[model samples]
Target: MLFAIRFTDHQSEYNVRKHYLNYHLDWLKQKRGVVLAAGSLREKHNDQPVGALWVVKAEHEEEALSIFSDDPFWVHGLRASVEVLSWSLAFEDMLKD
Candidate 1:
C-alpha cells in the first residue's frame, strides 16, 4: 500500500533537526520502499521548512511506521507530530515505464 507521512516540527525544537539530517537521508536511500516524493512544508513568506512530507510505498502501515521509527530525527525529538494515511495515485503518465 501507499502512504503519505505528514510530519510536523516542534515549534521550539526546529533547530534540533540539523543534528540528524544526514542519518535521515541515508536511511531513506537504504530503505526498500519507494519514496515517490518528499519535501518540507514551507512558510508562506520566507519559505522556511516547518514540516515534512513523504510519500512511501510499503507492504503495510506497520512497515511504514517501522521505517519512520528508525529515523534519527524522530529519535531526537525533532518531529513533534506525525500522521500516516493510505494513498492512491491515479496517473502513470509521468512514470518512465
Candidate 2:
C-alpha cells in the first residue's frame, strides 16, 4: 500500500524545523526503500518551507503511521498537524520505478 503523509509546521517553528532537518533527513535515508518520494512544502511567494510531504510504501495504515511517528520532526514536535491518506496512483512518470 501507498500512503501520503503531509505535515504542517507549527507557526513560528522555522528554527525548530531547521534544527532537526538533518536528523529528519537521516531518518528518512534509513528508510529509503519505503520512502518513495519526499520533500519540503514551500510557500509560493517567498518559497519559505511550511511543511513536508512524503509518499511511503507500507503494509497498512498503522505501519504508515508508525513511520510518521518515528520521524524526528514528529518526535520533536515541529509539526502543527499531520494528515495521512492512502494513495492510488493514476499515472506516474518519474516514480513509476
Candidate 3:
C-alpha cells in the first residue's frame, strides 16, 4: 500500500533538527525503496520549513509508521506530530518510469 506521511515540525527552536540533518538524510537514502519521495514543507512567501512529507510503500499503516519512526529526526524529537493516510497517485502517467 502507498501511504502519505506528514511530519509536522514542533513549534520550538529547541528541536535540534539541523544538528542531525546529515544523519537523517543518510537514513532516508537507506530507506529509498520504501520512501518513494520526501521533502520539506514551506510557506508560499518564505523558505522556512514548517514540516516534512513522504510517500511510502508499505504493507500497512503500522509498517509505514515504522519506516519514519526510526528516522534520526523523529528519534531526536524534530516532529511535533505525524499523520499517515493511504494515498493514490493521480498523475502517475506524468512521472517517469
Candidate 4:
C-alpha cells in the first residue's frame, strides 16, 4: 500500500534537515519500497521547504514507520510531529513501468 508521511520539524529544527540531507537521500535510495515523489513542501507564498511529502509502498504501517524511525532527523528528535496515512493513486499513468 502507498503511505503518505507528513512530518513537522521541531522549533527551528529544520537545520537538522539540511545537515542530514545526503544521508537521508542515500537511505531512501537503498529502500526499494519507497518512492520519494516530493521532498520539499514549500510555503504558499515564498519558496521555502517547511516539511516533506513522500510516498511509500510497504506491507504494513509498521514497516513504513520503520523507515522514519531510522531517519537521522527522527533519531535526533528533530521531528516534532509526524502523520502517516494510506494513500491511493487515482490517476498515475506516468508511474507505470
Candidate 5:
C-alpha cells in the first residue's frame, strides 16, 4: 500500500534542523526505494521549510511510519509531529510499478 506521511517541524528547532540536514539527506537517500516521493513544505511568505511530506510504499501504516524513526530530523527532535494516511493515487499511470 501507499502511505502519505506528513512531518511537522518543531517551530523552535531551526538550529537543530540546520545542524543535522546532511544526516537527514543521507537518510532520505537510503530510503529512496520506499519513499516514492518526498519534499519539504515551506511557508507561503518565505521559502523556509516548515515541514515535510512523503508518498511512501509500504506494506502497512506502521511500516510506512516506522521508517522515520531513523531519520535525523526525527531522532534529533526537529520533528514535532507525524501524520500518516493511506493514499489512493488518482493518476495511477503517473507512477511506474
Candidate 6:
C-alpha cells in the first residue's frame, strides 16, 4: 500500500532539524526501496524548511508509521505533528507503475 506521511516541525526547531539532517538522510537512504518520494516542505518567502513529506510503500499503516517513528527527526522531537494517510494516485505515472 502507499502511504503519505506529513510531518510538521516544532516551532523554532530549525537548528535541531539541521543538526540531525545527515542522520535523517542516512536513515532515508537505508529505506530507499520503501521510500517512494521524500523531501522537506519549505516555508513561504524565506524558503526555510518547515516540515517534510514522504510517500512510501508498505504492507500496512502500522509499518508506515513505524518508519516515521524511527526517523532521527521524529525521534529527537523535531516534529510538532504528524499525519500518515493511505494514498492512491488518481493519475497513472511511470513511477507509480
Considering every candidate listed, which one attains the maximal lDDT? Answer: 5
Candidate 4 structure quality by residue, lDDT tens digits, 1-97 = 7789887767577678878888877876776446646475767757556677777777889887887788776787667878889988888763542
For all candidates in order, the CA lDDT equals 0.78, 0.86, 0.84, 0.74, 0.90, 0.88
Q: Best to worst by lDDT, what's the order?
A: 5, 6, 2, 3, 1, 4
lDDT string, candidate 1, 25-53, tens digits: 88777764477677778778576568899
* Per-residue alpha-carbon lDDT of candidate 3 for residues 65-89, written as tens digits (9 for 90 to 100): 8887788889888888999999987
lDDT of 4: 0.74
> Model 1 reaches what TM-score against the true structure?
0.81
Model 2 misplaced stretches (Cα beyond 4 Å): 92-97
Worst 10 residues of 6 by lDDT: 88-97
Q: lDDT of candidate 5 vs native?
A: 0.90
lDDT of 5 by residue, 1-97 (tens): 9999999998899998889998988899999899988888997757678999999999999899798998989998999999999999898787675
lDDT (C-alpha) at residue 89 in model 2: 83
Instruction: Supply the TM-score for candidate 6.
Output: 0.88
Give the runs in model 3 whose Cα sits over 4 Å from its true position. 91-97
lDDT by residue for model 6 (1-97), tens: 8999999998688888889999999999988999989998987856888898999999999999888778899889899998999998886573553
Estimate TM-scores for all models.
Answer: 0.81, 0.87, 0.87, 0.79, 0.93, 0.88
Q: Would you list the clashing residue pairs of candidate 6? A: none
Best by TM-score: 5
